[model samples]
Target: MTTEERDQLRRALSVYVEGAPTAPEWQDWNFQRAVPDRQHRFVTGPVVALVAAASLVLVVLGGITLLLRGNIPEVVGEPVTTMTVAPSVTATTEMSLPTGPVNPAAYADVPSFQGTVRYFQHDPALGSPGWQATVSVRFAEPMRFMYTVVEERPGDDDFLFLGGAGTTFIGDGTQIWLDEADDLPPLQTQQPGFFRHLFYDSESPSPAWNEICGASPERIGVETIAGRHTSHIACSTTLEDYELWIDEESGVVLKMRGPLFVGDLHPQVDRDGGFEFTEFAIAGVSIPEVKIPQVEIAGFFPPFHMVQEIDFGGGSVDTVEYWYRDESTWRESIIASSAPSAVGSFQLVADGQVGQCILEEDLCSVVPLEGDRLLFGLQLPSPTSRVPLEFVGDHCDQLAEETILGRAAFHFACDGVRFEIRGTWVALTDPTVGRSDYWYDKGTGLAVKYTGEGWSWDTQLLELEPVFDDAIFVHQEVEEQASEPWPDTYVAADGIVPAWSGPLLDGTTLDLDDFRTLPGSEPGSGGSFVVVYDWFPTCGPICLDGITDFQKLYDKYGTTDWSVTGGPNIEFVSVVDDDVSVAQRTNERLGITVPTVACFADEIDPAKGHNGLCTPDSPWSFWSIGVPSWTVIDTDGFLVYGVTGRDYDFAELDSLLADISGLTES
Candidate 1:
């Protein structure tokens, strides 16, 4: 098909899967046809092995015979050690109830309400396969619980399942097992673990928890649910501010709120706001086990445009919700918005830290500035197209507000923790198109809330805590090396390619077999100085600048003993489109025509992919402007010089070029 027709087809598909795939045209078949890699990584990992072991322990305790079964006492009566890195919390030695009347009736029938759990998650980031939301947990008799994650968002034609049960811990008289299956990598698993250790522990020193879920031994007022009264306890933590309803008589937890992504992503806008359970059942039934696909989040959205719908074409689309500590709620409106640029540099921060920031976006650091104003770097998106957006700051403010489901919200004020500032985000399209609310408390600045159509997660401000030893709140840019200008210190050789091979950029080509080095035995090696110029056809300014620089370098150093060559522009042409071999041939035909420096300009082999031996430090540094380029060979055919773009040193080039020429420094 013609490129124009192909472009049109791609655009049509992009628009078709914007909402619930209620249409037959976009079915499972189409979903399978779309997503990049269909394989699921969670079901086949070392982590899953732990889950299986947990199940085996439970079975052995009950005297069940299985190949993987363990000793009954070791599985049940024996202590199951749990190693955790938790925050320090100071507590009184005595366990006293809160200053309130005991509501005995509130704790009834809590133990009987235990059963399997099932749920789904939706994300606004349409690119992710929806596996984070939908969750199902099956509690073993007294407390063993096995949970499975089935299906993800973006609606895949087929569902991936993760098979496993949760760990067991003894609480009061009943054994308890909480399903924690969201440990899949590429999903920010570490962040969740950080939360678990900080708040859940009563020994945690962080006072945030007490503010949300009132401390134990202290009785809180009672609340009625489903014709039964229950004791309500509220607490908050830096990671997750939560509340728990306990059956006063059974001490069983009937309902809970605030076990979600916290920190900047979930600022405590309203600690008073929380989630309420609508229903409860105590039954064991097998829900379909689903393996969740591992998703890697590359970058963040620009500070504009509220996302409306994320089209996960098939069943891959799963759970979607907003996790924010806000009292104003969310509303819908017809707002024009612009999409952020997609071309971005990919870098890995440490092992788990992965970031992809635009080259032009402003990045500020925490280092003190000499002046009142702070200087920062900007990472602008690539020269690609951006989504159009009309900024509307106050459009449908009242109508667009809605309460997020299943999210726990909290608010806080501490001595060291303070908010720097908060502001209304206005998209570029219109000064008043969309409004974004940010919260900052103490050492960690603004706690930002992130939510897309069907996906949502809160980035804890403290999770990515800044280390001032180097710099904080500053731009993290990878510095590139710079090499000397080319050609002035380099030279191109003619008859570089075999005459029988074909035509070169400079037109004429002759057999290089006749050439000899100073030692006489090495062909084209004795007394010959060779340099390789690197250039890319698609690298616009950078490539052009490199070739021009190399040409000039050769002019100043050109001599009977010096020769240079560079691969035809075809090597630099984007391989995404044309065939490599065809492009290579075409590049040789046009390499010399575009630009180059040669000893015998008419005898150079343009058909040869490269002008000469790819030299590293012969003036042109490929590492700086392009990938890796420039390899210089001496009279003995030994590589004597090499350099990569941006990182090349001019002094080093001078030394290498002199060495290749067999000339001593003046």
Candidate 2:
């Protein structure tokens, strides 16, 4: 197929499966990113393994993620499109208000939309994520756009470089760029998926934006923004809902309001006043009064910190801190613990970087990141959500108004929730949540209580502040009267995946030591090459296909009797970060041939798939930040190669096998 055709098919499949990097880019990254052995380093003397552990930079994201490469095409890809990002609460359009209901879905994402939209933010705490932008777009086939922010605040112009005011970003469905000026060669260029969260795509769209379980939006009249008619539409995929203002003539979303990629949303307006579009028309939209979409959030959204006491049954109760500052940066610290600082005591996340420290050992490690994401399949909702019910999915029923901890709250009957604390995650009120009660404060939207099954727990909001201390955000701190841990600095080094062992879904133990024996030095003859396949339960179609293809890989390249005796060539193991039960269900559903494990027994499962113990800094050491990654270990027990992401192909394994057994020239 032609490159254009492949790209087209890639876009089509991206909606179904989380995306992969362009084939050539991924192929180039396959081994180039892995650790290259210096002759002395591998000459069999004790060498210091950098505590950083040669961790590869990879990002795990929902929907789709992209990593571009090489040079740019002078001519755009097929159906290339443009886009901008930002949202406000509510605002009056300059044009006369129109009559009747309009369906934003029908006009989901149309090509060729260029307009300037006014931005309004009423955030008292965060001040405002960003100011408005005057932008123009042609399409998102590879969504692209030219953008610059409208400065209303003192530093509102800072967002032209991305500050609290908001970001100035645009993408041509294929290539995405941020904080670059026109009339200059692009200083920054990223894969289309990199800036995806900023603009809603128009082509081969995912169901999350346009269709919410086939639910219909409430058409609440139409307003003319930028002299063009727009439909104000609202809908809830669940208890939490969102509102969108779409161009009536085109499906281009004028302003997206509701939740800010919030796993949480509320019935109440996020905070009012939004973008007011002033101009409309294409031919590379000039700043003609700049007609733009202003997204008006409902309430004050800000960075925050909260302390809660969680009872983990037994005499073991733990105190956890939840801190969030934008989605890119945050920290989870355990000031006091019932048990010992259970492995990786403190974790600091900023953008793609995750820094973990074990105070007891004076050891710390930083894992490089690839994109906008969090580790271990965890979701960090804006602390200010009026009702952060995104994780509740649709399995919830509203309950009567109630008071908890002397604060007004909204109750719900739903399945249990999986909350992350320390290195492990737990399902509070799981299974029986449908019959149980979960309560959250009306204003803060923080869960105060959960009563379900045979147990009950309540969160003591010892403190909920609208602000985050900048000092705590530092990766390495001296730990003097701080929320984070001590000796945060002093990075350590270690070679070889830590003596990793975990329980398979069937409850069998998998020890890396079991596969380290090498009978002979003949190429492809002996010395075990353990191939580890990483996956998460939430991974999309593309990742699922990789797992399915793993079966074929095993059949052709992997040993047939490794389980019974030993395999000289390859031993394959698939791992999930969640509970083994979940992996069992996945195996049963997909009929995977590769043995699957859930990282640990049940105590510390991953968010949805991240192996809590296999964090890039851990012994099992695969980056917890990526899904569907491939890591190869040589008989010497060193992680020699890591392939971040690419569509599944058995041949890739063939190449890895060649590398591990020293048969590259063959």
Candidate 3:
């Protein structure tokens, strides 16, 4: 057959496979049957090759259809089309009483919309490299909504291709599906007013808007945006200034610009750094048909596995593998590439039970999954209809309508914890405290971007796909395994305190046993007590509070002569799990008068007595889950009382002190 004929045949075959009722008439025209005007040529050469290729494609497609049978649902209903409704701009027009408080209720209506938003950030102080992300969003009520994200950064080429296929919230926005098999809870519980503003150009005037615009917005005259005439308005908050251009007829925010602040209890905006929308477009969108795939155990028998490599900085890397078994049961295995012997594994069953096994220690423990324990799974928060306005306290103030990437967001400032962002990573100081600056999309109530002291996260939507896999919700029996009890050494209150000798910050080298003897007296004289306080310099504000409390107690009773009672004289010593310089710094910062000992040296070599006081092998080291643990050692070197964490029983401490002082209770 001629090349032209071959091309024609290919097109005909494609059409037939795509649901054509009948094959093309060319199928009956065979070259093998002698043509009336041409010499007979048996079907050979290119024709045979072309026929074979076409046959293979058909076979493959047929096999795929068979495999997906019953799994892929047929489209049952006609395509649903939703129109984008533009809000009336009269309420926002200059003639509409611009001198009064803007009524929030006037902008409460929200319309559905579908569009793309892009974000870009540049900070020369953080280096010449910058960050960028693209998000695509689709919204349809009574069904499901989707958002996909693709991110990129200079010098990080791999992230350019690493896209978040985004996530889908199914059913009345209660259930969420992520990746291919992971299930998560909804991001929001109710529809937020901001969604109406971001997606539909409709306004939902919130308290934040009233607080910011109520003061009196300066009208900057008229401006044109995307061919639409808009009224420009300038506003300000306590932390940042903003400029917004609103469509005069639709009341939709067409363009916005302002400084970016971290979303935390304390608003921290970078005077030199800000974000703006580069492009925004609204249009009607058709809801695509989506089918939740059925999950069968037989499809993933011998276990389906996935591996991920994590870089922990400082040249340390770890490999994590997820292995799925049965239907809802899976195992996570972690191996330290630098230390092969350091291996850990966890098994999660459908019944919300999780088991952790330490291979090197030959130990395993099983526990129920709840609260923060869910972090072990591949679940994440979903964007919901309600912007978490509760996080904004009375101290918060509305800033401006800011365009981040392409999405119009309502920017607000409030008291929040401060954080520092170096590139994409964020580290918050005083992690327990602080509020964040929120850039909420008015249309979706989705927080497209949030910033706080040291950190920020921007969600850029990507393509949406069905993520439901019922097997992920299946429950399985939790296999019970005998676990070894945790080791108890200095941690035991009744155990004998281990012997240790070290130099104090006051230039005194002494053994713990020395405290048992009175100066210039016999070795077996009166008993004495050693009060050891263990703490970390990097602990949160609560830890500092603990230090202050300890200092107050010491000042009131440190020198008291408890020797009159049967109890020994008290000697206070603070052991810090850091270098001497850090320890000294903490003592000075807290105004602690007590002597402090460093656990490590500047070299930080544990073998050379660095961190020796806090090392697990040290007898003086008391195991604590957190900072500010207290240990009381009697004159005989026995641990009398050991407490871990905060909220100590001060009554007990007072009672012990009274007994030692030989004083009777009132």
Candidate 4:
């Protein structure tokens, strides 16, 4: 590459390593409206205020940056492009359930109780009177109970969340309706909220709940919870059963135990499962004026985009009010999404605009929709939050298949991104969450909505709007015979990079300086690792014992800048048998390719002897493993650190690297 081209590539790599740019001031307020009933608020006691203050403080806390550096084998090139291979479909079992006998009484008696619970409270810290939430439950033919909660503090806003006392319900119910939509904030598409944060119906709760409930009733028995005598029962259809406590003499229900919110996306509260009955008085059925808005009643954002304009009723007129959120802030711009593309492979168009408005004049009076009010649809991620495609490294692995509700799912980790795909349910180590099931269409390569407790949203693929030049999308196939790997022909742009050079059990030279620089290394920079092996050639008990412990460490942190290499050390072609010279090794290892490997040794000469370059030299610190123990020089070519003999503290090695990386950062 020319000097200018090389510099440009270097700069690009540096920018990527530094991460995406800090967002500019956000002005994209598509929708903002005041609640009609401002007086209707929930009771937030001092405890709530304290919790809110803590959350706010935690968000503002800053963190320290640590610079880490490492090197992989020469075979793997820099800026690794990871490919996620979906697992092959497994054969369907002829008989779905294993032949084990079903327990005689596997199902539990699940009570269908309907009632709204209310509460009143006061907080000293907020100096405000508490709020109230009134919930009405209907079980059989409108037979129900209504709960009303009142907070009587001195001074404060009295607005309660849905899950708060007064209106909270425990039965399985569909959430994500227009009533609660208006209160939410606009959600960023790519960074969707965690599944636990969303709502789920009570019937099908989280997978973890299934595992706990699936245990025999004996395993989930009666216990005194919160000083209340209670009995635990498992429901056959739902993840949560029933915890019922009654008035011993009257036989009337006293307290109820189950999931508070009835949504697939509700976050789990393991300990807070049962509700104690306070004062229950009989009153005429009353419909508390519950003003369910179209947006999130509480502040919540949806994953969507919006566009708006202020004036211009005619063609080519003036007065445009364009706004968009770049992840954090709303931004105002003269240009609109309808305008031509400026950069990247994709342009995020709001779901509201696509297939709706055509000309700028048509969109002139378009008012921006409130983010919280947007239901799931064809929403695009805000432009600023879209991450550019980049590769992870070689320590990727395919996890086992997870099956749920007769649909199977697969999970794997490659580079750094975790790939989870749902298919036909199969048995998994853990019970599957109802919402985690994402069906990907084979033909279209897009996600189909997975079944939730009671409702399902179609996560269908929108149009593949082209953002890149046609040429960029075109793929090329390389002829195997024509494609030779690195270190075989060319060298890194910065020239010779010295690495590990030692003797294999076969007396062959072992040099591994060729792999791509561990994720973030500048040109001309390098690192080291010790490749220890148990067997001379083949596998046996000795080999197993020698490698087992080291393998454990590698698994915890695979291919880190500092790691202990595994596998038989015979992969490297020895110089004696192959007649591969040191210069040849250098050429083969330091070439342009995907994940290449290099070496510190030059050649294998039986007569002239192994290349002397393997020893300590300038810019490289040499190290020893044992008598026959050998390692390459450090970046500076000096011999400074070494674990000689059979003694080595694995913890010390990790700490040393951590210290070095810390110093570099400092």
In order, candidate lDDTs are 0.27, 0.44, 0.42, 0.25
lDDT of 1: 0.27
Better of 1 and 2 by TM-score: 2
Cα misplacement distance, residue 643 of candidate 4 (Å): 35
TM-score of every prediction relative to native: 0.22, 0.31, 0.34, 0.25
In TM-score terms, which candidate is top?
3
Q: Over the stretch 1-666, how does candidate 3's per-residue lDDT look in tens digits?
A: 222234433332221011112211211111111112211111101111133221111111100000101122222243544434343334323443234422222332323345444433333333432334444445544234544442223222222211222322222243222221122112211223212323213333221333455446776656444444555666655323455556544344554443332111111112222222223335544544434333211122234344444443334344554445433355545533433322443334445565554432233556565333232222211112113433332335778788854667877775533321111112223435566677665544444556664434454431122242555433333322222111222234344567687766667765776776555666436767777677654444455766777777677557777656554567777877666655665576568987677766655543454546655456654344234677677676666666655646667776776666566766
Show the lowest summed lDDT stretch of 10 residues, model 2: 38-47
Candidate 4: residue 357 Cα off by (Å): 17
Q: TM-score order of candidates, best first?
A: 3, 2, 4, 1
Error of 2 at 649 (Å): 6.7
Best by lDDT: 2
1-666: candidate 4 lDDT, tens digit per residue? 111222222221110001112222312211111112211212111111111111111111001011111111011121222222223224323213222211221112223232333222221122332332223332211212122222111112322333332212211121111111112211111111112111111122232233333434322333332232333333322112333333222222334433333211122221113233333222233322221223212111222232222121212111122123322223223332212111011212333321112121111122233353232211112322111111111223435654422344333233323211011011122223332333332322223233333323232123232233333212222122211112111122233434545454334445554432444666325444233321110112232233343444444333343323321111212111112231233223322111211222233354543244322242122222112121222333332233322334556644543443332322
- For model 2, what is the alpha-carbon lDDT of residue 84? 43
Candidate number that wins on TM-score, 3 or 4: 3
> Candidate 2 residues 138-257, lDDT tens each?
332334454544332322222121221223345544333343222112222333222222233333322255544233556655654445456666654422344566765555556654
**Model 1 ranges with Cα > 4 A deviation:** 1-502, 510-527, 562-628, 664-666
lDDT tens per residue, model 1, 229-321: 456565433223345555455443444433232221111111222222233344333222222222211122222212222222222121111
